[model samples]
Target: MRNKIRIPKRPVDTTMSKTTIPVFIYKPEILRTDRSLVVKNHTVKPVLRTLLFVLTLICITSAAGAQTAEELFNKGLESFKWQKSEEASEYFQQAAQADPNRDIYYLYLGIIYHQSGKLQEAEESYSRGIGLNGGERDRLLLNRGNLRTAVSDYDGASSDYSAVIDAGGPLSSSALLNRANMELNRSSFLLAVGDYTEYLVREPESPQKETIEELLNLLNTRLASDAQAAATAAEQALLEEERRLAEEAARAEEEARRAALMEEALQSLSSSGEDTKSISAGSENIREDFEDSALED
Candidate 1:
């Protein structure tokens, strides 16, 4: 104000007055870059969350779909117990398909088939069950034996029953009784007696006393008849053997006697020849005639 000085005007593009406020720096590029980074983080977060949720759902579904073989087996048994034959068959078939290694499934299936009167199917099922494992083989054998007996297949029944006997356990008495019945039907008295005796031996003493006594009486009658027949056969065989031996001895003794007589004759002939050698020709002739007559007599 004391001395007014004229300030030079400067070009806007080149220079600024010292009194001018410094121009504010507008960093538009930095602001835009930070905003883009925020958007990227937000987008990625949602995608990652969606991926995790989908994975968890898949795991849950997979776990739910899994079921144990034994659980399915129990379901099949329940179906069978309700007398739903067709439904039971389907359940068992499924179980068997799921775990073909289990023999009990096949066994149950066989029983169902038999009850349904599907004999051939039942037989096949039982045969397959037996082939699978030995644990229930006795039951299969006993059932088959019963089937064979029903069909009058005595030989086959006998074979199966005998197998049950060899397998042993509580089924032994039933098998023995069945075998005896088969033998009785076939008129195999000796075999029937043997089986009946075995049954009696294995049976309990108290409850079956009267029944056993009756059976024993019948068995004893058959056994006595068999024993008498056996005795008669043995006696016949003995008589034939004795007759053969006696005939052989008589032939041997006759041969010995003939040999001794021939030897004595030869000795007598030799002595007579020596005595004749010292006699006159006519005396030798007479002695020869007398010796010939004596030999002839």
Candidate 2:
């Protein structure tokens, strides 16, 4: 998906036809400056990512296991702040063991677990922390959402992102941005657009404004495409339903016509039966009169 924006123009003549006594077109050297912004746009923002990570670092008061938990937790934080993964993990593990009741203990421990590639442990820790009312609801959900995405749990990720948004924390825009990205991945075009729109409304002066604006335009296009497709499908369905109803009505009319003909034929047959009986009775009376005339003569 990461691609540099380049515009290509055709030469006036057949450049490769130089060997046939024709002209040649030299390759235009795209100036270095022309690609800088494009490159910057495609490159990952490491500093922003790091800052977001730092924001999730928790500071909890381990009351019952004060000395041990406090010492270990501080050590974990200091080590993590200095980018010491192993040391931080060790400290966080010990701190969490010392004060299992402190929600933050499990929260940061889960973060260190993820950093160390202990995905299962990370997931379990996050779940436990969330259940115990972790350090910061918004930050925890954000982290869980990210982890869910890494594991291809799109629905779970969306739910976490939504929870963060509903919480209305300082990172609401960030949550919206993440949710938008997730929606885009799932091809939920207009939904993603909605999230990005909310993001713009929340943070008007965001440093990533230009990039977000570009993304918003692209998402809008996708939304339009999806809407068009849906409309087309709906129209087709309507046509199909109309065709079915027409066929059904034609069949019902044919059946009714057949029933009417059958009723008329039955009535005619009954009348013919009654006429035959009347003729038979009249012939019987005439025969009796002839026999009486013979007797009288």
Candidate 3:
């Protein structure tokens, strides 16, 4: 037999002007009144053991067979709050299978997989959640973009970020920032600068404002230096072309001057030859006249 320990109820207070103060009575039920009595009650002990076993079996059966999706999701939340990731993952998976249309189940499952380093599964889960086109779409896209970035899939990450930006919501600024980072990874400095600037415009009071501003300043300085270098190279090329043209002109002028001098010398020699011919002819005529006079004498 069991023993019951009873606590007496409180009486009315005499000093409180006939006030009735209610007090709770505690009743404690003891399974054993004495150790020697329990040792003699072997039949009672077996019944108690059977009752505990049946209760535990019923609890397990109900949990495994009769729980709804919402109940499972709540249980998952409790496990997640306690940092029991594996247990939470099991519950979330069950919840998602039970109700495939619910976005939150897949969302939580994706987050759990991501934390567990199951990247492919996490990506698939996020994609499913995004396909539902619910309120968590931006969140899913953002997470998937981050996962793609981790795997060096810059193109996919950029696409996801661009989608989020085009949606034009609270996450647009974050999308801009993430896309800027992806562009930086791809070595697209100009694109990165544009995205970063847009992010700053959208989120003027962002917590990362100072850091982003410093990076932008450095990028601007580098771009300016590159522009100056390109301009200098173009100027040098133009100067080289001009120098080559000038040298060609000088050579042409010198050739023309030498050709004029040669023509003048040829003309002088021809005129002197004509004058000698005339002088020779006149001497011949004079000699002939002298010879005729000598013969007559």
Best by lDDT: 3
Candidate 1 Cα RMSD after full superposition onto the native fold (Å): 28.4
Q: lDDT (CA) for every model shown?
A: 0.71, 0.75, 0.81
RMSD to the hidden true structure, all candidates: 28.4, 22.1, 17.4
In candidate 3, which residue ranges exceed 4 Å CA deviation? 1-64, 234-297
> Candidate 1: minimum summed lDDT over ten consecutive residues — where?
21-30
Can you give the TM-score per candidate against the true fold?
0.50, 0.61, 0.59
lDDT by residue for model 3 (129-248), tens:
999998889989999999999999998999898999999989988888999988888878888999999888988999999999999998888888988999999999999999999999
Q: Is candidate 1 or candidate 2 better by lDDT?
A: 2
Tens digits of per-residue lDDT for model 1, 1-297: 022222223234221123232222221212245335222345445555555545434432332225345655675677688897865676677667778777787888888988888877877787787787667777776777776776788898898789888878678688888888888788887788788778888885637557756876887887898889999999999999999999999999999999999999999999999877767677978988999999999
lDDT of 2 by residue, 18-40 (tens): 22222223222343654462334
Q: 2 or 3, which is superior by lDDT?
A: 3
Clashes of each: 0, 0, 0
- Candidate rank order under TM-score: 2, 3, 1
- Residue 132 in candidate 2, Cα distance off native in Å: 5.7
